[model samples]
Target chain A: MGNIPSGINTPEILVDVEKLERNIARVAQRVSSQGLKLRPHAKTHKMLEVADRQLTAGAAGLTVATVGEALNFALHGVPKLFIAYPLWINESQAERILELMKRAKLSIGTDSVAAVQQMAKMLGEKAPKVKLMIEIDSGHHRSGVAPAQAVEIADAARDAGLRVHGVFTFPGHSYAPNAIDEAVNQEHKALAEAACLLRKAGHQVKRISGGSTPTAELSDNSVLTEVRPGVYVFGDAQQFELGRTGWNDIALSVASTVISRHEGSADIPRRIVVDAGSKVLGSDRPAWASGYGRVMECPEASITALSEHHATIDWPEERELPGYGEQLRIIPNHVCVAVNLVDSVLAIHPDGAVERWDVNARGLNY
Target chain B: MGNIPSGINTPEILVDVEKLERNIARVAQRVSSQGLKLRPHAKTHKMLEVADRQLTAGAAGLTVATVGEALNFALHGVPKLFIAYPLWINESQAERILELMKRAKLSIGTDSVAAVQQMAKMLGEKAPKVKLMIEIDSGHHRSGVAPAQAVEIADAARDAGLRVHGVFTFPGHSYAPNAIDEAVNQEHKALAEAACLLRKAGHQVKRISGGSTPTAELSDNSVLTEVRPGVYVFGDAQQFELGRTGWNDIALSVASTVISRHEGSADIPRRIVVDAGSKVLGSDRPAWASGYGRVMECPEASITALSEHHATIDWPEERELPGYGEQLRIIPNHVCVAVNLVDSVLAIHPDGAVERWDVNARGLNY
Candidate 1:
């Protein structure tokens, strides 16, 4: 279990340690040199080892998508953490958040007055008022209050005696190819508007945060003090599709063995079925993706379809297909979701020796 | 966590221990009463506990999608296991298959001569030859050899001194609502044709395995000797959309809390955002699905969109939405993938006691 033996079985998620380190270093260096703090999203890797590398590479703190993720990172001694997600504050979550705050310097996100009020009730003379960041809907329309409403929420936080840290927005629309620039522009506009609104409302908008993997490359660091780019560390098919990164930048792949072959036929040409299917590789083929996932070796070929246990790969007529049992690495469309699906990832060194890292944060869905 | 605590969080996956037991019993009873052997697929739960229940419910064996899954069940002492997937035979898988054969009766699926030949080479001089199941493409067209070509692979398996046990196909196309009947009919035709072809080729086709959750409900057991239905134990959105099961039959859900609220504007109506997103709930919204998933309490509403950490839920006009931090349960579109994303599932008893079972087969991708 220490070193993933070579020819490691099918549907196994393999991470090239060398490439991963390089990917981490590349992002860390870019963010640090820009004088902006890098709070790499732990939601991507969900692995203690990868998070450690991000911290080692000069990350100011870590960003987690859930309280459970925050707890896992805290357990690994990640000192400063941001629960980037706008959590719903409940009695159970309040208890968990209070306990987590005691263990680490934590900041939580919220977009509603009710949430802040609930947080105030939970804090109630214990451990001081928690820091809160107002989430603004910057074109994603997924979460967050409107920029106009940000001031109201910030005021509510202040009224609740909670420390208002900053404003945050996720330009998740950036995931679409050719939408990165628009997303970054939207991020800047939303954060600027929200910051102005908060300031007008007599609150200090100290930290203006925005940036997804796609927009991070073109982010306006002047308006935003921090950028949370999760997937940059291990570029995925989404990043590639969005023109944010090249295939060479993809640092992770699910290594799988070809288990079945359909020779050239009149109707269907050469096709190979791999052991990696929806169960392992995930069934996340975004509307923009060429297929469910891209084959690393045969980039032209897409995973046409996936059964629960078999990846149906249709190769081009001109391309030579690998024989049955041949192992091929696949770059998944969405790296974060794929990472979350597995228990552990094979961390392979430059010399090809592989180390196994437990996905300690594998299932922190609570 | 031995007993799931009361108010055991919203949007949390709860496996009704009783319902799950009933589902197991019902399926097992059908198999037994019909005089057909039951080989429950472990890909759905990926839990040893669930597999144990299947066995205890009179399952003749267990069916798995991967060698890794097969190994997991075998380790848990399930002596008979079928790797129902058309596996690509590699050196590592071959070695593992040989080892698995030592502890459990192993049946593997293949669709190519190359795979059969490779497996044959790997099983050379083994105590017992691995049983082979020729996968026939019964209109699912995802994987499996052509029904007419089943004998080619069956003959190859026999020539390799492997036990050509039977033929198998996944009526995966039945997952779509309109295609269920057609897929089931095609499955019967394919199985019948393959069985006849194998028998005519001087091979005994003892098993005719075909059935997915959608087709299992109306499957003609008279034609097939065995039925492999994985998702029936915990019905998912696919089953519901396919009209295979009602919402009451869904056994698992992700408990999420409403984190944010937005008042209606001229352009947009009132909305509530939940903490559960694609990462936890999985981004699987088939065209027929109401939304990304079904809300347990508010079945009328639909989750409009999902960012990595946010689920944007739209409500009808003037409806009182759940307050921020109010817990809500979500039934994901695909339960199998959602379960695979998490490490452990919280099994909730009727009395509100929660037991955490190790997803022993959680990341057995290979």
Candidate 2:
């Protein structure tokens, strides 16, 4: 990565365009080789530039987690968009989705009969091309229904005059250590079973979408037609630590200045404090993760704790601590959360020009 | 504790103005009773309306984390502001701060001679009544120098033509369970020692500031001239779980919709999924925190995991799960981080009128 501009402020998100494009291209190629369509999840970057790059790199469509995000991308003229979340649509949101449907080919996810009925009730007879994918559990157990239960949601949607566009599952369990193989296996099985049940129920099981960044490489195309991996575009510390990506593949980082450095005392260990804390880096440290985040410049350094405006890096006494005012790039454990925290990100190009990309879909949680 | 407006969307921040005023007044009265000046940290709410409420409640000044935040408040006509962070000021930041000094009485925290020298050099001879407070490490061990080292920093600042106003420390250790008394005690001792050292070296330590929300009520006025409690204005899950504040005292909460609900199968446990996740309610789950956040309606339930837009609640099967589209209030583990995630908050008044309060200093993380 190129050096951050001295004119730019510290504790800012810096996206390396070269690595970003390479990461997107590599994933596109891998998905193509596996005979699967890539519907890259736009929830990761939430930037129009990143979404445009992914679409230009041969992504079939963009997957989002909210109607607001879908509308944001749709308004930006993304032809096809998928809200890959089981949304509990209110009347206003339903109206917004209906309006969005006129601009883009939109498909939302539903795991329950109640949500399907609510959408149907909100839209009534004026509903236009309402399409939904039945969400399957796939061992995540957070959202989505059981493999057999997908048929019930599909039946409800079909009865409610909404088109059932096959099934989808999020292998959220893949985020953990050594669970990728099992998560991928469960994902495949759940999608296959759900698709079979839907087909048996006389529904056209056209798309079986399933994939997380961790299990994207091992995804099987036999039962799945499209994969929706979000974090592949910007490799995070989680991906790197999980052996999914290399140091060179990390595209997005927080450019932070070391504000404080301390030598070991009897009560405290030697540490360097950076301005990028939970507000910038986010506080998404999984149980298995090494620390709050990983320092790209000093891999051995562990960010032991995070205050709102400070990240305490536990430096090895052997290595010299970074000097005060020295800028260091940090890879957040989860890049999506980090990206959501900022208004815009600084994108550094290979030609040494840095541009700011607005996170247009930021904070569109609804 | 009023019903959320139907027009407002889900996963949005809702501030109870009544509780907010009460929280501010209660803390103000307590600090006043102890004869300590209240300089509530603006980092928690970052809203002008909330800051105004605290100021009206007799806050001496506002405390901020960065120069950008300080400038935001200063521009909003807050007369006195303290950047309660050990900032590594660059030339540009120094220039901004220099411009800021013209409008407000500003004091910044410093922990090292290098930072003091950098600030002094950057401010040049045109520096306007520069006030520097030596930060002492009062057992948090994140930033701040040792008690004896405070004199060194104060000496450097004094030698550099900067006024050493006093010393301050963040009793961050108080956030944990049963750590309040010890943290307050240590805070008192650290400030006392640092003030004594600075006094012995011929520096007039006028304002010895200390106090976090957990230790604010237990603060010793004998050593501290001012208590800077940020989170007391908006009680969070941390404060509520730690017994620092009652449930009725929580002012800010995320209004979320129950998007999906699932009964336990053989492999999965029963859970209710809400739209408000880590993006709305930040992912700061301290080791001692019960979960990601707390549900006001269902205190018995635990938010087991959070996705970017989904919070999985481990709802007890004994009670019927909330229906789809039902709105519930969630108290985030860290109110400051949660407040920073949104552009504006909906402040519900006592008479049922809801007003939008723009988070003016939302992303002003320098």
The residue ranges of model 1 lying beyond 4 angstroms of the native Cα positions read A1-5, A32-35, A126-129, B1-5, B9-11, B29-35, B127-129, B351-353
lDDT of 2 by residue, B1-366 (tens): 777888667999999999999999999999999989999999999999999999999999999999999999999999999999998888788889988988899999889999999988888875427678889999999999889988888777877888888999998988888888888899999899999988988989999999778887777578999999999998999899899989988888999999889878676778899999899899999888899999999899999998889999999878898988898998899999999999999999999999999999998898
Error of 2 at A77 (Å): 0.8
Q: For each candidate, what's the DockQ?
A: 0.59, 0.81
Clash pairs for candidate 2: none
TM-score of 1: 0.94
lDDT tens readout by residue for model 1, A70-185: 98989778889988777666677778888887789988888888777877886676524566888888887777877898888888777777889999988887777677777888
> How large an RMSD does model 1 have?
2.9
lDDT of 2 by residue, A1-366 (tens): 788888667899999999999999999999999999999999999999999999999999999999999999999999999899988878788788888988999888988999989888887775437668888888888889888888888787878888888789999988888988888889998888888888888889888999779988787588799999999899999999899889899998999999999997786889999999899999999989999989999899999998889999999888998899999999999999999999999999999998989999999987
| Best candidate, TM-score | 2
